[model samples]
Target: MKVKTGTLNRVRIIGGDWRSRTLNFPNQAGLRPTPDRVRETLFNWLGQTLYGKTCLDLFAGSGALGFEALSRGAKQLVMVEQNRPVLDALKKNSEMLKAQNVEMNHADGVQFISRETRQYDVIFLDPPFRQEYLPKLLPLLPERLTPEGVVYVESEGAIDPGEGWEVWRCSRAGQVHFHLLKRTHA
Candidate 1:
């Protein structure tokens, strides 16, 4: 769980059978998973209704967020990661958990989202902070997300949902911000 000097340590998986399990993270140039406290808060907001919901974890770094959803009770989980090493680690973790419902995709998160036709109930987007990916990512969400799906986006507190997205809730812990947005049904 030793992170590089001045960097953060391994984030705990938060809940379920994998609770307290710490996954290793490589010293890649730009990689920061959501902190455990923020994740716990997010899941608490989600409550006990995640069962049977399909989930998509974009920018699935350590696959921690997606795994937590699966552990809780997600019906199917799709992890999209572009980094080879991260994808490898995600695969190993999926195997370790015997996650047959977890599907791993090695590609750009945006590209996958654009090509994805199947919709998901929950989508986790934890891209690098300050990258300003939400604006671009938000518009594409309508296509991949279910009509009433919930989106959990963790950023450095810069996301401003103008008018198209109906933000259900927003909260911040430390420097991290969590958003719960829902797409209007058409």
Candidate 2:
């Protein structure tokens, strides 16, 4: 379950401006980047273009999802990661890509979400699989989205949208269950 630290691993940008580009990340436990097949499916569900959208990548491990959004024309991307090494890699990749629209934050995902007042067009939630973050986080997302916004959640297994949220799309790849969720009434 844990990859050796200090090993070099990289993920490729599957489409958009940075297509075929690679970004390196440290091999840290639970630091899984969204896999290529899963990301391709998720982006397809989101539509290929993210033009002018504001996105938040909470629990951003490798910055894969956020960077992909930026590459696809998102207006802005905010990535929050609490792990120091992972955060460093994210910063390095942001600079490496000349990502002017990306913002990196070092903070706990739940704490950051608690204090954030601005809503996002898309929010990527890919927390550590061992933690029960979904139960607490799902309830907080509806208020954090724009009226027509969506939230992409990746977990170890299938998860319900809970209460006011509805599943826009859902799929599985290996051990990951990923879903695009939207507020039912919004």
Error of 1 at 186 (Å): 7.1
Q: What is the TM-score of each predicted model, taking all chains together?
A: 0.89, 0.97
Candidate 2's residue-wise lDDT over 96-169, tens digit each?
Answer: 89998888899999999988988999999999997999888888888889999999999998888788988889
Please list the residue runs of candidate 1 whose C-alpha ends up more than 4 Å from where it truly belongs after superposition.
1-9
Total clashes in model 2, counting residue pairs 3 or more apart in sequence or in different chains: 0
Which digits, one per residue and each the tens of the lDDT, describe model 1 over residues 1-186?
654543334667778767777676555666877777778888988984478899999999977789899888899999999988778778877877787688999999888898899999999999877777877788888777777788998888746766577778888888888888887654
Separately for all candidates shown, the number of backbone clashes (residues 3 or more apart, or on different chains) is 0, 0
- Extract clashing residue pairs from model 1: none
lDDT, candidates in the order shown:
0.82, 0.92
